[model samples]
Target: MRKAIVRVADLRQQVYDNLKERITRGEFPMDHKFQEISLAEELGVSRTPVREALALLVRDRILVQAVRGFRFPEFGPEEIVEITEIRLRLEPYAVRLAVEVLSAEKRTALAGLIRGEIARHGEADTWVAAHRRVRAALFAPVRNKRLIEAIAHYEDTIHFMRVNTLQDARWRGLSVGGSAKLADAIEAGDAGAAEAAQATLLGLARDSFLAWSAENA
Candidate 1:
């Protein structure tokens, strides 16, 4: 906790990467507040780098400034719908591209990941991790960096909701089925089927998330 990061050149980026990992891993509770001073102390770095990292996270919409510090941003209904619309448009096409170009060996690998997703339904964490791996594998054949980056940006922006959405047992089951469909479509080299499966996958995810948001609201 007290050791400084050895990489001086990318100090700011290191800080950003570390904080982002913690956020994505659900380490910080909602009640926990982040300040430059405490973050620098925790990371054994100067306040300047910590400040810059926090600024970047805010700019990326990963966090929002609070009265005294930064906290995870809470998306409202409108923002959630907008994000869903964008993802629905982008991901299906990406999956189609991936299916069209996916190698047979990589298709086999993707099928393995999806099988794990179907089998690891015991705990939410394990299931979520498996699902994430399959999602990444689904994009392995995508050669377009910009398209992949765009998909990642929206996914990152709603990362918290995506994680929580899988906690619903029914949705998790649906997700596994959808992932299986994606694998089948990819294995068959049916770009059209892959695209349709991807749309269904994203739609189910969005609906579950919207349900959770509505209930929580």
Candidate 2:
């Protein structure tokens, strides 16, 4: 019975990952309602797993309860600003911790990842993946598991908004440049410069989101 329960839990996690990937890729329209029956049918799964996955996503703030079911929450300027504030506080501290603990080899590896992403300018998905690797490198040395988990959770929650913002070529270019600068600072073991680079990156992102929101509003 324990083995059977473990298999079911694993299946539910798989469903959750698949749905999260779809949402991140913008396959589902923002604010579109989700139906557990339809999703289960599409994925060739049962409603129990789909229902459980949806509940997990709702807890992650990636999905919210709607009148009928769940919908992806639309982020506005204010929401973006709030996310930015949290990122600015949390990320720079992470960078500082990273600089203190990262070995020279790890720094070199991080630089390589940043350069690779910079070379792949127009491919949003690849760039985002590489960017994530860079972040993981920085956070790898942090001893506090809970802080690292919080950072990862925040990143997942804002995944869609970040991807949508990168859809703008100009913003994408600026983002790559910021990453390059950040990588350089980290490689040099300059904590202050790394923190500054993180601030610049988040500041540009915050400004871009606010501008887009104002224009749309």
Candidate 3:
């Protein structure tokens, strides 16, 4: 019975992870209506696990239950701004916490992320990918698993929008400078400066996104 239970739990997690990745990569469009039966058929799995995984995504606010099936939720300006607001609150605190534990080796690695970003500035797609790497490096020093999880949850909500922001040359420049400033603060072990750097960049991103939302709306 225990072995059977483990298999079921593992299957559910696999399905959940798979669906999240597919959604993130735009395989599942916001207008794409899908149900457990179809997903199970496509994934060659039982509907039970698919249903459970869909429920989990719904609980995470990453998916919406439609009348006929499930679909990715479309974010409006308010929803997008709110997602950044949550991050703005949680991430700086995460950074401050990280300062207490950031090791010399980790600081070196994080500084390397800025240089990598500089080297790839000419590529649009790489800027997005590199920014993601910078985020992962910045958060690596935080020892609180739950805080890290919270930040990651909010980050996932705006992954595509972050990519969009980095698509612009001006935004990309600001972000590269921000990464350098962040590395300096972290290397100096200045928690206050680190927190300020995080908040300032995020504030700029939030403002930039809002402006884009208005123009594109």
**lDDT on C-alpha atoms for all candidate structures:** 0.82, 0.80, 0.78
Q: 143-198, model 2: which lDDT tens digit per residue?
A: 98888888888787877756666777777788888888988998898989988999
- CA lDDT of 74 in candidate 2? 72
State the lDDT of candidate 1 residue by residue for 42-91, as single tens digits: 89999999999999999888899999989889888788888989998999
Q: How many times do residue backbones clash in model 1? A: 0
TM-scores, all models, native as reference: 0.89, 0.87, 0.81
Give the runs in model 3 whose Cα sits over 4 Å from its true position: 1-9, 25-32
Which consecutive 10 residues in model 3 have the weakest lDDT in total? 1-10
> Candidates ranked by TM-score, best first?
1, 2, 3
Evaluated with TM-score, which candidate comes out highest? 1
lDDT of candidate 3 over 1-217, digit per residue (tens): 3555343348899999998876654454446787998899999999998999999989988888999888767678788778878988999998888876777777666666667776776346567767776777778878889999998898776655665576778777777788778878887788899899999888878877777667777
